[model samples]
Target: MARALLPLALVGAFLLVAPPFLDLGWQNALINILIASLFALAFNLLAGQAGLLSFGHAAYFGVGAFAALHLMARIEDGLGFPTPLLPLAGAAAGLLIGLVAGFFATMRSGVYFALVTLAIAELFHSLAPHWQGVFGGEAGLSSMRMPWGGLIFGSLIEVYYLTLAWVALSILLLWGLTRTPFGRLALALRDNEQRVRFLGYNAHVTKVIIFAISAMFSGVAGALQAISNETANYVLFASGVSAQVVLYTFVGGATIFFGPAVGAVIFTLFAYLVSDLTRSWLLYQGLIFVLVMLYAPNGLGGLIHQHLRHRGQLDWPRLARPYAQATLGSLLVASAAIFLIETLAVVFSRDYAVARRDAGGGFPTYEVFGLDWTPLSPVPWLLPLALFTAGLWLVLQARHPIGALWQRVRAGSEPGVNPS
Candidate 1:
């Protein structure tokens, strides 16, 4: 009973705490986070569990959104349907399309499977603009949310709750599915497809079924997005959407169930809040992805798990000095790189040139975090360069000590090892 109630308690706590802190804009961002989480979760189901890398999952997502919009339009025109049930239309569409597409796509595996999915998605993307009657051209389809069950869906708060409920239900269902026999078989197939085939299981059919189910959930997310935005567009079918889900799942830790959820929340928040602050947000995101791939391939969740698993064995007092030094050195190197990049960017940017002209200056001083320096100044460039060199030297000097400490920690954390 305690174990069963833990999840409920956590969710209840989240529901209580999440809304009050967020303004309308942030509440909307939260909705995006929920939707993105579901999409990433669906992708993880296939990629993480079934070992099927799909590069065209966005095709199903777009189809669902378009289907939801069409349903809304139809209902508005006189078809009897409740507004709340519209997501089912999207789910059905996604499932049907997934069946057809998965049949052919699943016939191939590995890179061939990925390429087939990509081609299918691209085909839909190309057709969406030309099939203006159905796709509503570039503008896509828009519909107003009608009053249903004494709730007006006009306010942000209402929409947030509605999305939250659907997301919660979807997550529960997906989690439940993971505990079923089919889920175990999917895992087995992922680990050894030939063994599953030898065991008299139709691996191809299993893959197709899982693919369809994954697509169905992706559709649900897309449907919710359509209802929230009241529009669906060709951009939904773009390869970038699929790529974003892959990034979210992989970066969050595909090995764990909630890893993609963590990734989705972080990615959505960063995109929402950080993108407005800088035009180089994509560069930062790419850098993060590169770092994660290089240093923590299992992702943020894996890193967290590793820390937790080894926490008891970690000699914090002994390790802290080196860790702090290494961190400081790394930060200095990163800051230097950022400073150089920003300075060069400002020097060449039209916006900066205009700002400089407006300031009536020969070389306009740039201000960042209360520090003012001219982009053309040698001092600005030389200071960071010197810092970078020093930091790099310090890092090199500390590498052996850090490496030895890390190995010791790993050895101590091993199951059979004696910490002493």
Candidate 2:
């Protein structure tokens, strides 16, 4: 109970401290962090605990968003209740969709399971653009103020708080689920499907229940997004968004309860920061995903776990040199790649216009460091490009040395190094 209560205390502390210190921009970012954490937790319900990879979780999100939009519209028209009652409409819609989807999807497992979910999402995505009455025919749906206790939802801050409340509730519920019998059964199914069946349990039913729960949580996220933003678009059902949620869940370490939450915060913040600075933010995202997949399948959480396990038991001296060498080489390689890309972009765009009006002038007029500064001539770009390539080559060469050290450690040749 103490362990369970710790996060609540931390949350209370954060809420007390954060608002006074944060500007509007940071407050908005905090809201986004909460939203993403909810979304990641929803995805992790099945992906992490049940070992089910879903590619169409956005279907529920779309449904919930539309439901919330409709409910808000009704409330505005005096056909529905106050603002607080609106989430129920969204939850009901989510539950209905989850039940239907779960029935069909639980028949398959592994890759086929994901494909089924994707197909459901794709079906909805296709219909959303053409189904005029139900989905608003590509124009999507709109939401309005709920007249909360005769108070109006006028500020972004209020919306942020509303989202925070919902997110807090959702996280609490999911955490509870993780400690329940159903959660244990879901993990059991993940480890040994045949064994679960041998115990006279209907594994399919267990899967369906977990999937529905996951879908419902995802729906809540979608509903929050729609209501908070005051709009819902077909883009909410897109495969790419689903893929990103999966990526977020995996990158945070699905094994631990808080792993997805951490992943969501980091991923969303990183994306926001990178996108603000560069047009090629997607490239960076892809790079991070690939590197994480290769180097840390269990993600940041897994790495932390490993470190904690070995920290006091192992000799610090033997590990320090190789770890430093690997870390520095990795940073150099990333820097070199980014430098080369910017250099090429500058050199290749020969007739690029420098808008001095936007930059406040005197700057070289290329885009870097969130400011306009670029190479005046192709030669400048070429020089840096060549230098970066050399740096990259040198960095790549260090990989060999790192690998040799890792191999020695792995082979049990290193004294005081714990392989386990």
Candidate 3:
């Protein structure tokens, strides 16, 4: 715990102090990071801890957003609701819907449970557009954040702080839950539900509670989003929203407690930085998920934990070299992929077609990676192919040394081992 303090304090300081210096676009992105991190963490509760993978978590998230919108509208109508506490509306709606949904969904485990959750979210997505009164129809809902206390609640920075406070508190609570007896039981459920049932614990009830808790927190995350944006559409209930959270959790390594948030922050920031530069940002994100799944199946958090666990036994410079090789290989592969994707996107674009037609039906030159390359040219095909081959070979080569290094550390056989 003592060792954890310094890092946590520095992180907290960065989060608190850095936003004021950022431009509006970055401030908005930071707010998004907070919300996405919270959403991933909440999903991790059910998926990671309880072994219940909810594909329709967007259901609760949408509910929370709409609920918060309704509250904001009320506050707009001169009600005395505190702006800071508006997320409770989301929390309440999420818990209520979660209990109702969990009752039926938890009856079945595995794919059936996932399908049921998917069905529930689809149900919401279907109904939200037509049910204008509650969901505000196709227009969704919109409201203004009212002033509370001396705070104006008018600026992005103000909203960022509000979101930060709520997210920090919610995460702290979720972490605390893992220390409770119920937390251990959640692990049991994840490992073997049959044994938990054999112990006479009400597995169904336990699942419902866990699901509700996950949804409630998910709702809070959604509320923060609504608060920041001041509007939401039925798109919140879309399957894409649900899928994104799943990606964040597994890609971040759901086995580690804070891994999903780690994934969330990285992906959110990635999207922020890269989305402006390329239309294939989603493709890049998917490629990243695939690569992580293939090589680092334990996820980033697992890798971090592995290093920390063996920190005292390892040689930093020696270990760092293999890690660097792996990083270099991954970057090369990613660059090759980006090059291929961008080239394809340009080649298949309508403007490219128009240009080709104007040029008498010939393949045209396209700009990519700050250089122009002709379609049907051998260079474009050869470049990524060579990159892919070299990157794969480099990665494969690094794995042997990396594995051996870790093996020696595990065996306490490495020379110059530091007892500290």
- The backbone clash count of each candidate, in order, is 0, 2, 1
List ranges where model 2 is wrong by over 4 Å: 1-12, 309-311, 314-325, 346-420
Query: TM-scores of the models, in the given order?
Result: 0.90, 0.83, 0.96
Task: Output the worst ten-in-a-row residue range by lDDT, candidate 2.
Answer: 350-359
Lowest lDDT 10-residue stretch of candidate 3: 411-420
In model 1, the number of clashes is 0
Query: Per-residue lDDT of 128-189 in model 1, one digit per residue for the tens?
Result: 98898889888888988777789878888888888888888888999999999999999999
Question: lDDT of candidate 3 vs native?
Answer: 0.92
Query: Candidate 1: TM-score?
Result: 0.90
What would the TM-score be for candidate 3 when compared with the true structure? 0.96
Show model 3 residue runs off by greater than 4 Å. Answer: 412-420
Q: 1-420 in candidate 3: lDDT tens per residue?
A: 777577678888999999999999999998998899899999999999998998999999999999999999999999998999999999999999999999999999999999999999999999999998999889999999999999999998999999999999999999999999999999999999999999999999999999999999999999999999999999999999999999999888899988998899889999999999999899889988987898789888778777877788788888788888887987888778878889899999999999999999999798997999998889998999889888987888889988887777876754576533
